[model samples]
Target chain A: MEESKQEIRLPRLGEPAPDFEAPTTHGTIRLDDYKGSWLVLFSHPADFTPVCTTEFMAFAEIYEELQKRGVELLGISVDSITSHIAWVRNVEEKAGVKIPFPIIADLNKEVAGRFGMVHPGQSKTETVRCVFVIDPNQIVRAMIYYPLTTGRNMAEVLRLIDALQTIDQHGVATPANWKPGDMVIVPPPNTQEMAKERLKQRYECVDWYFCKKKL
Target chain B: MGCISPDGTPTESGKKMLLALQKGLRSPQDIAKETGLPLFRVRSGLRDIAVAGLAEQKDDSYELSPKGTELVASLL
Candidate 1:
């Protein structure tokens, strides 16, 4: 039955995100340092690559806005800091967006392997584009894996972060194709009486079982 | 100092240890436990024992050589 649905091989989700302590141009950073804050742990292909350059620029432009929402970004690639520095410099000069986040020097690929980013069948020397959004409590809220050729949607990433946070904080869920400012799913009624009462109320909600409330 | 060069060296204990690790052992503590050596020494040995396609670290542990485990056995 499960196979009938697409055979999805996903990374470890709903658990503690993998911890990494690696040297960067900004010196060492332990994954635990971002424990109390939301984290966007992302992986990229080889350095100085064109597609990855655009993704980096997009993330950099929105880095501050993400932080305003109490989130941090950490980038990883299987390249040395020398390569990473050169790539960032090129992106900054050509793309005109300076990266504010630190890029991990995963030359040994320890952290990449831990996160299962190294999809050898796709590309042996490169990592498939992967992003993990982890909440403050160390649980993975969402994950996205992209093909090497197709660039990721940066705005969608921000929207997902917003959606997840909203549902979590409001004790609700989002409807299909949910976006910011859209109505959210109301919590299922606990008792039959409450269910009947919920149906009678007009809350922009469609039905008692599946109800929605404006963000 | 008894040291193995990062890039080049014919064969050292560290290299041998990496071979031993690739053959079967996973954790440095497990390798140390099997080798009857100090845990710290095992970690120090691995820092310089960078053999391509030899070993991979996983889940806060290490993985053995994916293939050619039999060829590695001749050394032990």
Candidate 2:
């Protein structure tokens, strides 16, 4: 069993996300059901905890924003469905914020194991904080992991989604710390002839290989 | 499916959405605004409502079918 656990494959970026069907606070949901939209599949350490509660509230705050961007949020942890329901209700009552998204009650840890959320060194029985940004095509676009002590930055999450969608829609890469409406990095030229033309074009080019453009 | 029971009864949010439709809200956005449910939930609920034959869509708007009208009448 230990050997098999060691061999558990962590999902990689640009690969199909491992499929899952799990019961949630809302109902049973399948990964395939979210194929036509972007999904932010995230796992927290445990429910009713301080950091996770704040995080849930933060997520609720951005739920509509994510919806506007055609993204869905699904949270998970190695907690029972009843526990999830109680905790979400508690959060709603105390924080006066509604959790609009579904949260997977991964009591069996099957989904956690598939996503590599269970880090033995972090907590053998609980999942670590992990985030997987999957595109509309169901491909894993990005992955982020946070240690148990630190809470995640929700703004960065929105920014990355913006970056991914911008990249897809405009066919350009975002520069470091890119945000919406910011200048985008153009694909660099490979051939010398193309390189010469790149500088002559209507872009902000430091050189033939480095160019940025406003979209 | 999220807001519908296996036997096709509308759950809380589903009932709210159907109620919004009974109030003559047609678009998902309008239903969401009227019911205060998340727009995503409203949209997903619309799909399930149509699947259950309770609502029908025309263009971007939705209204109750005869079955839906009867159900809402009973829900009251």
Return the top candidate by TM-score. 2
lDDT digits (tens) for residues A1-215 of candidate 2: 56555545699999999999888876667787676689999999999899999899998898888989989999999999889989989988888988988999998899998999999888988888899999988999999999998899999999999999999998999999999999999999989899989988999988888899999
**Candidate 1 chain A, run of 10 with poorest lDDT:** A1-10
Backbone clash count, each prediction separately: 0, 0
Q: Model 1: clashing residue pairs?
A: none
lDDT of 1 at A64: 76
- For all predictions in the order shown, the interface RMSD in Å is 10.7, 3.6
Off by over 4 Å in 2: A1-5, B1-9, B16-73
Q: After the best TM-score superposition of candidate 1, give how far the Cα of residue A5 lies from its true spot, in angstroms.
A: 25
RMSD of 2: 4.4
The alpha-carbon lDDT assigned to residue A32 of candidate 1 equals 65
lDDT of 1 by residue, A1-215 (tens): 56342222445678888767776644355676566678898999888888998899899988978977878788998999899989888888887889877788899888888787877767777778999998888787788989788788988888888888898888888877888888888888999999999988777656778777775
